[model samples]
Target: MGDFLDKRAEHLSTGMKQKTNIARAVVHQPDVVVLDEPTTGLDIMTKQNIIEFIRDLKADNTPVVFSTHHLDEVALLCDSVCLIDRGTSRFCGSIEAFKEVGQSGELNDAFMNIVKQGTMHV
Candidate 1:
């Protein structure tokens, strides 16, 4: 977090810049936080660290709203999910409900089906 305190956002590495962005977002202890693809373009290790940090936020009872195409991250971190297609909310419910919609009860399969068929019954 030194890069954040030092006022060196421009000089920071990509991963560090990402961390600084997360830090600033949460510094005020807001009731809810919104992030758009926080892990996009990050290395695997950095992505994992950011995921862990998000878990920490959850542990502290913070509500996080993030948009991502990374289904694996959703499986790991989300209790509920909202799937949108072409500016429409196709599904919004618990993870279990989403899994139940798939033929194989797999998130990726369900997501693909939703995108391809657009017939997921809510």
Candidate 2:
């Protein structure tokens, strides 16, 4: 967001580019926010900033649907969760119910157990 702001899009770093993209996308405050791996390659600070933005959107009651490999983000941000396995909805419900699925009360473990049960649908 420094000198890069004065430069062309091609000159920005991956994180900076993603940040700008998100900012531009949400400037109008759309009805819903959908992001794909939003913070995957961002720096810690940039990632944190984006996470806060997501939180702010939620606080304002804007529905946020983002795909992330970071389970911690899911734990911190989502009230309900959906797990897609091979283009199928393997699970979709409250976070607590999802936790119970794994029987260990852990996000990562829950995800694994869900995926491990390839034929199960909930």
Candidate 3:
């Protein structure tokens, strides 16, 4: 188990620590995984690697719950998304449906439009 543990936590960079956490998280082979800001403070290459790893987990039939503040990441990796603002549900649906509502392909634009309209009550 020595190889599975992060030995460099004290000295490693933030991205390295994040990667180490990810490695540890998957080592147990669980059915579900929840990651919060898994790609935070990482470069583009490292972020891509993390994203791809999540994709692979999904392909293997593992249910992954990913929480991220990056809308672009959500747009790229999520099949369905629920946008919550001020503790209210703004939108809950597929990316395609969300895009249709705003008549735009950009997820951020759609999210902004929904928030602007204040249509997420309840």
Report every candidate's CA lDDT. 0.83, 0.87, 0.82
* Model 1 lDDT tens row, 1-122: 64357666798877777777877888898999888889987899889988998999899999999999999999999999989999877788888888776544789998877677676456
Each candidate: RMSD to true structure?
A: 2.2, 1.7, 2.8
Ranking by TM-score: 2, 1, 3
What residue pairs clash in candidate 1, if any at all? none
Query: Could you tell me which 10 consecutive residues in candidate 1 have the lowest summed lDDT?
Result: 113-122
> Worst lDDT window (10 residues) for model 3?
1-10
Better of 1 and 2 by lDDT: 2
Can you write out model 2's per-residue Cα lDDT over 1-122, one digit (the tens) per residue?
Answer: 56676798887878877887788778888999888888977999888988898999999999999988899999989999999988989898899999888666899998999889775556
1-122: candidate 3 lDDT, tens digit per residue: 36635565877768777887888888999889988889998999999999999989989889888878898888778888887888888778888888877567888788788888878633
Which candidate leads the pack in TM-score?
Answer: 2
* Per-model TM values vs. the true structure: 0.83, 0.89, 0.81
RMSD of candidate 2 to true structure, Å: 1.7
Off by over 4 Å in 1: 1-13, 119-122
Task: Report lDDT (Cα) of residue 118, candidate 1.
Answer: 77
Please report the TM-score between candidate 3 and the true structure: 0.81
Point out where model 3 deviates above 4 Å: 1-11
